[model samples]
Target: MTITIQQQFSINLNALLDEAGVPASGFGRSKHVATSMDVGVATAGKWLSGKQIPEYDRLERMKEWLGCSFDDLLGRTEARGGRIPARAENVLLNMVGTRSATRISICPDEPASIRSDGVYALPIEGDVMSPYVVDGDMVCFMPAMSAHTDGVYVIHVAERYIVRRVNLTTRGTVKLIAENARYEAEEVDLAEEVKRRNGVRIVGVVCARILVNR
Candidate 1:
């Protein structure tokens, strides 16, 4: 028999709750989910009963709290031979323009250690990084306030977010290198930028890239 998405979600949620040691049926199950997701008990009950599915943000939160992927939560993917799917929260490049978060199932081959809660997925918007990380690719990163290593990172500066390979040079400056030769590398003084309130913030370090099929 074919199962609807709502039914699948209910089944998956119950299984996840059971795996987490919540009782199969009772106020405890709904209350636990409601508390964890910060929703009303009636809403949680609807989810538990297959009467409704959560919106995007709530679904993302549910997956994160349950330590599972979107596929796992929605019954899109199943474990085989003891291997679980990897997952990450999907965030947009322009945070100010859009404040939304969803979930994406990472490639199953991804290391199990990468399934941590700190991981996030950001879709590439332009060809600035090109050849290496082109437009349409989704890059996964770990949130970081400062650059501890010279590598590819997502940074917010001059009122925009950009992806670049950062190199900390002498004289309190950092060089932003674009993989594409068509673009020129730019160097900015970290202290001067901060003093000017340009807000040079290192958002995160890029750890994995999901390439788009040509």
Candidate 2:
């Protein structure tokens, strides 16, 4: 049977929240989301039931209260643009703006492990990292000069940037995995590809993500 946009949105929303690690009972008629977003319980319930889509302003606020992205909350598996901007330091940015790398500032509230020059802030255009990295969600990425124990990274290849999780296989090869299905995983043999011949390379490691308030 064909699904209406409302139905589809509902399905995607539930799945996305699940992926984001939201407990099913965390949001309900208890006025949790409604109170958090300053909306009515009926309005929040309607959203969960897919009876209505929250307005743009409410949607943005909901992301903050729930800690997700637009494409993520809506459950979109599309490809997002490459490269995002981050402060020169490891901190949480309250207002993340989309500007050239030269025009960003650094804050020192949230601390983490990252690099100096390796840290970059670029423009994110779409939902390639949807549910994980959404629109206006500029994140902090450190240059992945070497393999990390484990975590999502911004695989740098041919000057193009792709955000994904990477793994080092025992066969001396590296596996690249993306959060969205649109981008498939790539296995790069170190001894064969990088050592023997030049091939795709890792550019950056996504050590941190900064959620911007619209």
Per-model TM against the reference:
0.45, 0.44
Per-residue lDDT of model 2, residues 1-214, tens digit only = 3434554455445443433433232113225556767888777666654567778898788778656677655643332332222222323222122323433333222122334443555444465654345566655554556574555665545434556666778877778775445677788764454453234655555544543422
* Tens-place lDDT digits, model 1, residues 1-214: 3456876677567656644545323225677788889999889988876678999999999888989888777754344232322222212321211223355433232222334345566778877765445576666666566665566787777766678878888666788888655689988876666666556766766654544421
Candidate 1: where is the Cα deviation over 4 Å?
1-117
What is candidate 2's local distance difference test score? Answer: 0.51
In model 1, state the lDDT of residue 197: 59
Overall lDDT per candidate, in order of appearance? 0.62, 0.51
